[model samples]
Target chain A: MIWAVALSAGALVASGAYLALSRDALRAVVGVSLIGAGANLVVLSAGRLDAVMPAFVPEGASRLADGAANPLPQALVLTAIVIGFSLTCFALALVMTIRQRVGDTDSTGLRAAEPPAGADGLPAFPDDER
Target chain B: MNADLTSLVVVAPLLVPLAAAVASTVSAGRPRVQQAIGLGGAILLLGSALVLARAVAAAGQVRTALGGWDAPFAIEFVADGVGASLVVLAAVMGLTALLFQQDDTDPAPASPAFVPLVHAFLAGACGAFLTGDLFNLYVWFEVVLIASLGLLVLGKERRHLDGALTYFVLNVVGTLFVLVGVALVYAATGHLNYVAIAHATMADPYRVLPFVAVLSVGFLVKAGAFPLFAWLPATYHTLPAPALALFAALGTKVGVYALLRTGGAVFPTVAPLMSDLLGWVAVGTMVTGVLGAAYHWDIRRILAFHSISQVGYILLGIALGTPGGAQGALVFALHHSLVKGSLFLIAALVCREAGSYDLRHIGGLSSARPWLAALFLLQALSLVGIPPLSGFWAKFLVVRETLVLGHVVWAATALAVGALTLYSMLKIWLEAFWRAHPREDWQPPPGARPASAIAAAGLAAVTTAFGLWPEPVLRFTFMAATVLHTRP
Candidate 1:
């Protein structure tokens, strides 16, 4: 089971990396989302594969029994997933704004807005030209 | 046990700032209340850190196993000497950032949002330092990055957007690797606690390689090592004065502290080879960083690029893998946080007065604001490691340790880098302060002249105090070094 999960994660990361390198911003966002999911799953799986139940022991049961799962990773993954989701949402909004302003979402095509290397001081807003 | 009270030092750093962030948000339009809350939290955090520092100095170590669980099970907070010193640095930076926020008056009110974001960022930083678990460190890393992204986008500037995009992409990639590393470590060891993982890895050290690779990628990227630091110059240049000041102060030090904690405490044997690889990266980082600093005409961008180069020195000292080297690196890290943060704040004030950060447009402010100019000169001099300054002491420690370790070649290279750092600093001084100004129609806004004095005076006072009376900080730094280098 662990081996299968690990393979799935590897494949997910590879595909995500490919998508991240794509030209479109939306694809990059999706790629990040996928990567986040895969990472969470991988971390969750690291807590003892043979365990059949969550880490909570019933009253009168011995602590850290032979087959109970560790719940810390679950808690950690839940926190991480929330944080990752928020970051993705923010990143997506940013991408949307960039597209609206710049009129394109191609990652490669977004020209850096810096003036040429040796430009004089900050230029006045074009509207101020009049 | 009552030992849980020790967790207060660790928890307060995070909780107070978080509470302050929430408070600032609820009081949205009232900038004064936001500032007061933020400042109050920072002062309280500083007091907590000082108390912790004193406790650590007296006791050998202070341990707090969180959630009523013991170590290797519960999320632990350890306030060893090293962690205490970092907490102190965070507190100082927190205060300086608040000062910069108060003095700065950008067209867009950055203080309202900047206050909360800084609080969150500092909390994340302090969490990263104090946590004794690998996964908790990753959590803190995310917290820092999220807050940083918020600040990056808060002030709507075109260059900021551009820089933020690059920085965002690079940092996300770094975080991804850190996640991968944590998973790998967990899979191999079935433990997330620092001590348990350390023991597990020691039993089967070879199994740790994959995780180590992933973890190093995140930290190395965050530390602004070469080939991965292209984002820093552009991104940092785009941040507002207070945000940039905080970034300069504590953001990258998170990576330094992580590398130190993990390398020395968890995986000492493998550290030497890793440090060697890191040393080469440091060399590359310094060379490219200085070259980039020299190439830039804009004052802020120059400083931003120089930040990467200065981090290289800290990296080199860490890479030496000796007790003295680590101590020197710790001292350098502490000193750099103050010096760099102050310099960035000074640059912001210069831009405020001159109406631009571009050296080409601005000139001859020496006569106009002698006090600001003098402050700038002092900071600039200290950055270049002039004798009787904190920078000199830091540099001296690193160089001496390197020589003692017989890494003479790297030591020479570091000295050369220092010379180039001086050269770059002088270039900015000559161009921005001493160069003749063509009388432009622009005049500095009212009250812009004293801003640099405030920022510089704060830093200069600390640096001079430490430089002249090195006994206290030196002792603290030594204790910190021993905590990391000595085996339990």
Candidate 2:
């Protein structure tokens, strides 16, 4: 079970990285989301998965049972998932904005902040001609 | 201080900005009310920071476990001398940014969300500095990331979106790397608290090296170190000058601070192994950043690149893995934050008078606005490490530590970077102030406010004072270094 989880997480991250390196903005955003999911899985797996029991203290006990699952990684994964979700939402919204304003989704094409070099090789200041 | 009061003081640097963020958000549409709240919050934050600094000085470190949970389990906030000083720096930058923004009139429609986001950014920076738990640090980094992203896209311009996209993608990737690093560290040691992790890994420190490697990548990206800093220059120029100033001051320094806290303080055993690698990274960062600055004509881009180069100096100090090196890194971080921040604020004034951020399109400031010229020259010279200015002392400390450690090539690279830094500053000086305006009939803009100039001048004054009377600051940083170098 641990090997399966590890292999799946690795594959997710590898594919995510490849997609994230793509030129298309939308794909890159999806890639980010994929990578985030992979990370979340990795965090979840940090606590051993061998235990089948829930992380609970019995009615009379001061501590959780020996075979109970580790709860800390679950808590950490919960936090990472929420933060990662919001970040992906922001990235997607940004990609949408770029597509709307710049009229394309190509990351390379979004060069409004970095105008191409002019005749003298300096960045052509947009308002210079005015 | 009493225990309850001490706990409150320990958390105040974080809470003041957070409360301000909430209040500003509630008063969103009323820009005037929001600005007043923001200013009030900034002042209160500074007061809190000073108080915390005092408390930390009184006690070598002040710590509190939230919700009364004990150390290993509960999230902890600890302000040692290093963290306390950084909190103070954040407060100063927060106030300066607000003052710089006070009377500026930009043609772009100002976002009502700006003040709230600035406060959020401050809260995040303070939280990151104060937290003793590794996972908490990651959470604070996200807070900073989200707030800065909001600030970046406030203008809603195409350029703003462009820059924000690059920033978002790169920084989110870095954050994920950090998340993985945190998970791996926890798996290795079954601990998230710095002190706990240190104790857990003490027997076989090399067991934590792979996890630390992942963590350092995330931080290096945040610090805008070489080969991982494309996001910085690509995006920072898109910010309004005041926002740029705030980001310039606190953003990358947070990353450097994390490296110092973790490598220098928590995992001292691993420093020897990582020192050589970090030394080379510092050299690359210095050379790459200065070269990038040389290739840029836009004042903001030039300053952004220089920010990276200066981070190299601080990293070199950390890479030395000694108490003296930590001291140098702390002083340089504080000095660079003030000087570089003021330089950006001054650049904003230059833009106001000369009508462009591109140096080629703007000039003649030396003749028209001599005071601004003087301010620019003061900061520019200080940035280049001229004597009796803060930058000189900062560079001296770091380079001295490098030589002491016998890293001759690294020390040489640092000195050479300082020379190239001078070249960049001179480029700004000669082009923006010395040459005539590109437009023959250009005139200084009307109704230009003195508030921004006053803010810049205030920073310049602090830098000058720090240089002239370096004893107190040096002593404080020395204490900080000793505290950091000593294991908890």
Candidate 3:
């Protein structure tokens, strides 16, 4: 079970890296989301898996059973889920705006803020006689 | 008045900004109300920060654990001289950014969103500085990422979206990288608290080394170090003058602070590879950043590149790992925040007054706005590490320590970068202010106010003050350096 989970997490991360190399903003966003899911899995798997009982203690009991699961990773994974969700929402909204602005999701056309290369342009200025 | 009150003061830098942000949301339609909340909360925050610094000074460290649980098991905050002094720095930047925001007028209808976003950025900055938990730092980074992107994309312009998107995507990925490292470390060490982790790392240095290195790379990306800093120059140039100034002051330095807190705390685990890893990285970062700056003609882009270059100096000091090295890093960071922030703010004003940030067009501002010209020259020369300026002392300490550590190549690269930095600054000076007004009758942008000049000059004056009376800041940095532990 641990091996299966670890392999899947590794797969998710590898695929996410592959997807993140594309120019489509949506794909990039999905790539990040996949990475986030992989991260959550990694965190969840960090805890021990051989557990016969849930993480709990009866009323008036001072300690948990010896074979109980490590609960910290569960809590940490839950936090990551919520944080990752918000981050995805932000990234999606940014892509939405990017689409609305440029009318395309491709990042190739989004160079308005950067200056053109000296070789590709006439000059940096209009008055220069090239 | 009591322990609880004192603890509250320690957390107030985080609270005041968060509260202002929440309150501003309620009064979302009224810019004035939002402004009042931002400015008022910042003043209170500044006061609390001063108290926190004093408390941390009088004591060794201040820890605040919520819900009364043991530290590693509960939500916790710890502040030493480094964190507390950082709080003071954030508050100062917050207030000055607020001042600039007052004069910052946009063409669109007055939206309360600006102040709330600014408040949120401050909240994240202050929280990240104070939090002891690695997970909590990730939360604060998210807070900063969302709000700062919200600020960046406030304009519906295509360029704004482009820049904001790039910034958002890259930073979220960086945050996830940090999370992976944090989780792996937790898996190995069974603790998330700094104190606990320090103990664990000491027991098994080899186990902690790889994870800590991953975390360091995560922070280096966020800090805009070499090979990952393209996004900074890309997005930062898109912000308005005032907002750029705010981010210029607080953004990358927050990452630097995290690097210091985490890197310095785990120096033992990271030592074997630190020199080879960070030394070359620092040199490449400084050289690449300066080279980028030297190629840029747009004033904002130049300063953005300079920001990346300046971060290299700080990282070099950190990579050196000596008392003098750490002192130099802290002092340089403090000076860079004010100097870089003031420089960007000055760029905004110059862009407005000259009708262009393109150096090819704008000129002869010295003949008219001599005071603004003088402000630019002073800040620019200071950035160049000219004598008797804050940057000079910062560079002196850093280079002296680097040479002492026998990294002659790094020392030479740093000095050479200083010369290039001066050349870039002079390029701005010659074109933007000295040569000739690009057009004979340039006018300031409509709704441009004089308050930005006053606010910028105020920050510049503080930077100058650091230069003139270097003792107090030097002492503070030395204290901060010692707090990280004396050579393990």
Please give, for residues B368-422, the per-residue lDDT of candidate 2 as tens digits. 9999999989888888899988888999999998998798999999998889998
- List the candidates' TM-scores in order: 0.94, 0.97, 0.95
Tell me the TM-score for chain B of model 3.
0.96
lDDT per residue for candidate 1 within B452-488, as digits (tens), equals 3565578767877887788899888888888787776
RMSD of each: 2.7, 2.1, 3.5
The residue-by-residue lDDT of candidate 3 on B381-445, one tens digit each, is: 89999889999999999999999989998999999999999889989999988887757677545
Fnat score for model 2: 0.51
Which candidate has the top score in TM-score?
2
Winner on lDDT between 1 and 2 is 2
Over 4 Å off, model 1: A48-50, A54-59, A112-114, A119-130, B1-4, B104-107, B440-452
Ranking according to TM-score, highest score first: 2, 3, 1
Question: Which portions of model 3 miss their true places by more than 4 Å?
Answer: A115-130, B104-109, B441-448, B486-488
Count of steric clashes across candidates, in order: 0, 0, 3
Q: Which residue pairs show backbone clashes in model 2?
A: none
Residue range A1-130, candidate 2, lDDT tens digits: 9999999999999999999999999999899889999999989988878986999999999999999999999999999999988888888888888888778898777777777753221221233322
Candidate number with greatest lDDT? 2
